[model samples]
Target chain A: MGREIKLALVYRDMWQSSGKYLPRVDQLVRVAEPIVEMGCFARVETNGGGFEQINLLFGENPNVSVRKWTQAFNDAGIQTQMLERGLNALRMSPVPADVRKMMFKLKKIQGTDISRSFDGLNNPVNLANSFKFAKEGGMIAQGALSITYSPVRSIIMSIWRINILN
Target chain B: MAGIGRPVSIGKMVKGIRERHPDIIIQYHGHSTPGFSVASSLEAARNGADIIDVGMEPLSWGTGHADLLTIHEMLRDAGFSVPDINTKAYMHVRSLTQEFVDDFLGYYINPKNRYMNSLLIGPGLPGGMMGSLMADLENNVKSVNKWLVKRDKEPITQEQLLLQLFDEVKHAWPKLGYPPLVTPFSQYVKNVSLMNAIQLIKGKERWSMIDENTWGMILGRSGQLPGELGEEIMNLAKAQEREFFTGTPQDLYPNQLDEFRQKMKDKGWDVGQDEEELFEYAMHPQQYEDYKSGKAKERFLEDLEKRKAAQQGLTSVAMPQTSNSESNVMPQSMTIDVNGEKFKVQVAYGDAVEEAKAEASKEEPKPTSSGELEEITAPLEGKFYLTKDSSEIGIKVGDKISEGDTIAYIESMKVINAVAADKSGEVVEIVARHGDDIEEDDVILLLK
Candidate 1:
């Protein structure tokens, strides 16, 4: 028999995809609760990755929305995940190391089971601190390899391996 | 990065990583910038990537992430073990998601965004910027058409302008040291490139419309560039000459937890242990404050509804007329009704004399004994921010400031240019207040 693979579904892109399809926070909460309860996903990539920006853009309190979503996932007995941009965390720009640490700590506390961290440049050096912080904060640190093609792919491959091992 | 669209290369890369670190969990995040992310993702998985990032089919392709359905099917077809995702449930969710995508097509889709560009491989515009660049191109073309019409020249189509902009972006990338085209940085590159393209289209000299943010990036204020910036580019940037930050950019900004807390307190917001709200306020003060004050939320919802109505091909219901001009009036306080709620706003025009006198009275008296006071002028024309936060003790009258100390910041073209003191001396007076628009070489502060 083939090995059973766990499939994690990332709906964070839906926030962007929905574009004008933006439902109110309450509406999203109502619709997502049943879907999350279906219990099919190994992990639901539900929050973070511009959730704050969308909330802000739509005039919803991000904290409230995040809290509600996380709680819903928790109630459904499903682990929730988010993509963290290494040192950048939630903000567009690179935040202070202290701020990045705090963000991980807070997310963990708020019930973020896993943080799939990646740097845009695929720089392992940048991912190191975020990985450390995520582990320290008691969350699973899923290191992301930003897949890009290059003639000298060996250099990045080595870096990616080294980053994960370290 | 260059092999983004090449799946075989990605498979090789992933295989190499897998071979090196057998125990490490690998997730693949691919963008459909060059319209090859789905294939690339499957390649990554076939080689050894454990987790592949994929979006719903409705939001997939053309600069979006890889489609989940495609990834699942390809992985299964390759004889790889797959997850037991309920196909029926997944499709149900997708159907709902498609409804949302359909509603938002007007806001998200544009002519430029609808097509795949092979040229994107050279400039490497991030997936996130696709929609925005399309919107920017649309706006730019409209302006260009207007200009052409005024000049009695043939109006160029949006496609032509988009191609020109793409060409300019490719040219600008090397000049800007090829900073990773991501959020914040992507916007910076796009702005500089767009400005350059527009200026070129108008037959203006190169670097004639250099945005301050681009200037700052060129000076290494934003972050380190990937390559050596050319001497000519640096010389052109010197025209808007300002002190460039040599050290790490984050060093210039002090922690503002206490200041934000205080602001929250002053605003009568429920100051609690929520770091999330604090972080939101820290990153976007004005927006957060507006949200907290119950103004921005109302406006956003109203705007969103209007857009939604327009998207549905339904006529937008007329909103109650509120005087936009009254909102702009300064010193004159006015009560305006928005959605039946009245908000009293008092707008103070530039440097109210009474407020200035009151502030001067609060400060310590200036010393009489001094040499001739020298004026430190602004290096460029921009809005001067006195301090990053209210808690920050900026240079005031009778305060000793050192040479190269950042007394204020002049924000122009979305970049904050730190205003440093040329010579160390006691601040005799602060000529420019917070949010004051000062001209080039205007006196910002007086030093004795």
Candidate 2:
């Protein structure tokens, strides 16, 4: 048999693409249940990437939302995932190392199986802490390579080195 | 991810990295800000990028990242091995996501943001700022419309204003040393540019509408800009100087975990081992406090509806009157006609004693020619401040001031507007006190 390729669906984009603000928990649950039952995907990118901000902004409990989604996905026999912005973790800016670690731990306990980590600047130094926390929390750690174009040859070379090291 | 639009450079860099680090796994994350992220992602993939980040269709273009459907099709067409994705199941997911989108659009849709724009490439607005920019633009347009109506002038189209604002942002970026357009920094740049554009259109002086946050960013408090700011910008920063940090911005933030925990505990929050709740409180102190106290959700929903109605040019009501004297005092009644639709708004004031006391505390009464004293009123509703520097006591009683001299500042809509003296006179009584919230047409001071 040919090599079977695994597909991880980023369902967060589905809501984001709609160019709308945060979707209500009930709305998310209704949409997520059917997709979770599909069973064809390797994992579903179901949380993080501003969902926490959305929850806070709309006065919703993020913990409850995460737990509900995780339980729903777990029941459907599918793993859940999140995109962790390196130092940012879940906040607007970088948090303390302890805070970031706590975030990973909480997500894992709440049922996030995979954590895709990426730095905005493509700096390996930034991604290191996230990778450590994700692994320590027993979640799949997927490192992301941030691509950008610059006319400066040295900057481009440094980016290449960072990518290689990651 | 940052800088995801330079396809050729990223491609070359990726190829070079792949040649030496053959064992390394590479995943591409690109943002579609400059309308080149998809091509850049493909370029990286062809150069041995093992994974490429993409969003689902409908959320996948314009300031969003690359589209997964487009990528999947392209990769398959190029004879590359791909996943056996359940198409039928994916469609179902799309529909479900669409329902969420529909609900969101009902409240927050900005018609201007519904299409892609070529102008964004020059200003390089981050994907994250699209919604905020649209919202700000809409609000600015409404303000401009009201101002124009008051002056018996024709209001400019929102599109024209947006284009002009874009041009201003592009102009301001270089002035601020072209800092990477991302969160916090992006918001700062957009705000500064928006204010600059609005001020220019309103025939106000430059930096007249610069806010505290933007001032902080320029002074290197938020973080270092990519390069040195212009001499003009720096001079302005000097005038409104505050203690600025040279190190990482986040280091300046005091640890608040213990303080938050104590407060939450006092509120009877049984947060034992629930790190998530703690994190919530830590991330957004005020919002989380309101939420836990059961006062945020309802207000948020009500505000959302009001905002949506305002966007639709329909009748929108303001927040209910409260007895808190600290709150900004709004007008008791006002009549506004929009497109021939008149709105009669009735505002209820709080306790008269508290209101009078708050006003009196800010300004001390001084005797003058009772009929000769000219009362200078506030031009807008905002937080009033006596001086940018706290150490220096601002204009006091009997101080001589010249016309056009800025005696105070009012912060409104995130912009700090300078309150200038309309006529030269000795200060008789300062009515609007420092840090006191004031309304439009409120007596700021009396001079003779």
True contacts kept of each: 0.24, 0.27
lDDT, candidate 1, B200-230, per-residue tens = 7767765554544556567765445556676
Q: What lDDT does candidate 2 reach at residue B426?
A: 87
List candidate 2 segments past 4 Å from native: A1-8, A13-20, A37-43, A72-89, A93-98, A113-166, B2-4, B20-24, B31-34, B208-224, B242-244, B248-250, B304-448
Q: Write the per-residue lDDT of candidate 2 for residues B329-402, one digit (tens) a residue.
A: 54567676667797886543322223233343454444433788887777666568887532346889999999
Docking class of 1: acceptable
Evaluated at residue B107, the lDDT of candidate 1 is 56
Please give the lDDT score for candidate 1.
0.63
TM-score for the first chain of model 1?
Answer: 0.86
The predictions' CA RMSDs to the true structure, in order, are 11.9, 10.4
Give the C-alpha lDDT of model 2.
Answer: 0.65
